[model samples]
Target: MHLQFITAACLLASASAHSTFQQLWINGVDAGSSCARKPASNSPVTSISSPDLACNAGAAASAGVCQVKPGDDVTVEMHQQPGDRACRNEAIGGNHYGPVLVYMAAVSDAKSAVGSNADWFKVAHMGLVSNNPDYFGSRVLNDNCGHFTFKVPAGLAPGNYLIRAEVIALHVASGSGGAQFYPACFQVNVGGTGTVKPPTVKIPGVYKASDPGILINIYQDLTTYVLPGPTAYGQASPVPATTAWPTTATWNTALQPSTVPTVVPAAGATGIGKA
Candidate 1:
């Protein structure tokens, strides 16, 4: 009976490692779950050409759009299941090492926007941060309790925008079509008067299965890891082959909310974590 119990525990742990982006934090405030259109499951989308690569597979539409301004620090949080925000577990476990990317697309209606139909532009990206320690973006996220933070481009035009955060797990990416893509979308209303529209790329068209970054072996000592998507807005492509990416995490884990944030109605305004 003891042996059987041990086996079951291991199985549960393995299943929990398959994660999804489940929460959002804006400027150090927990924006709650309503703003995020989280995937129904933690399973990954392997096909790069599928429309599911845009937001996720079967992610129901979200009614709430979190409010943000240009230059606000936005963080996306991931976990194996909804409302599972434990700090001890790795966000994407089982040696799933790869990059964390964030994209932004202006839309007519953030709450109802179809991710596949929007033109997405890269906003932030983090790949292998260090070779000596063999640290990856996934590791960074795990260190911070599944939170990956990036800033809204300074001059982004104010409007309804869809923020897509993704993690590309390259553990089994040695062969073609082996990379696993986990993407989640969030609705946000930008309130700045800034007007700058960067170049955009379609989701299904951005990543190719044959891309060097998507079809590499992370088990070996990789001198460089190329990011699959285009250059982030107002930032140059990071050359990991020669330059070392900073290992310091910008998001403060000490201030992390112990409980998941929730929205409360007060004075005709819905509070944090709600629309």
Candidate 2:
């Protein structure tokens, strides 16, 4: 009886740390689940090569496509569960430390883009920012109430695109397959006149099981961390973070809306919110 109780407690504790990107903030406006292709559950995709590694397992297709222009300050929001955006609790509880990466893929249709084969390009990545008493990007995300913002490339061509937001939790990454990946997708139509197409790579093929970033020991005294995936849109290389990443909360929790933004379907669009 005692062993069973301990195992149950352990399982509950482990489950508390799992999270998913469920909301989006465009130019500081709460877009909510408008164009979000939220996963079926707030769970981790363990297999690196699994097709689920792209958007997430069992994520339904989204019919709503958020309209946005280039150079918008887009923020991806995460929490332990859907529609639970309390600032009192950590967005992702437990010490599920790792990196926060965002990738973008251009497609013919944002609403129907299958993430498995689409060409994805890294736009923003935040890995280990400090080592002396190590601080990770996941920690920064928690500090900001689960909001990580990045800008849409000003030179990106106007078209349909999928924004893939991911958080890798390395708490149990001492072994080969112990890492946890939580990725979510958002569909958007970029409506600018710019016409620059960045380099791209497929999702499942971007992350290798043997890659040092995917398979690493964060507990050890580490000086550098190699970020996974291809080079960012305009960067020369994936530079390893060396400076001390800030831990203070940037997103105003006091002003956070208790409810998600109401998504009004566009003209001729039948339905909206979580297909």
Task: For model 1, state the Cα shift of residue 55 in Å.
Answer: 0.6
lDDT of 2: 0.82
- The backbone clash count of each candidate, in order, is 1, 0
In TM-score terms, which candidate is top?
2
Candidate 1: tens digits of C-alpha lDDT, residues 1-275:
97576456544543446889988877667776768897978999888989999999999878788888899878789887778877766778877778999999999998788899999999999897777656788888887778887889998899999999999988777789878899999988888799899999999889888899899877677777889999899998765534454545455655555576555112234223311
Note the Cα lDDT for every prediction shown: 0.81, 0.82
Location of the lowest summed lDDT over 10 successive residues in candidate 2 = 266-275
Error of 2 at 194 (Å): 1.1
Q: CA lDDT of 109 in candidate 1?
A: 96
What TM-score would every model get versus the actual structure? 0.87, 0.88
CA deviation > 4 Å runs, candidate 2: 1-13, 236-244, 264-275
Best by lDDT: 2
**lDDT at 46 for candidate 2?**
92
lDDT of 1: 0.81
Instruction: Estimate the Cα RMSD of every predicted model relative to the unseen true structure.
Output: 5.6, 5.4
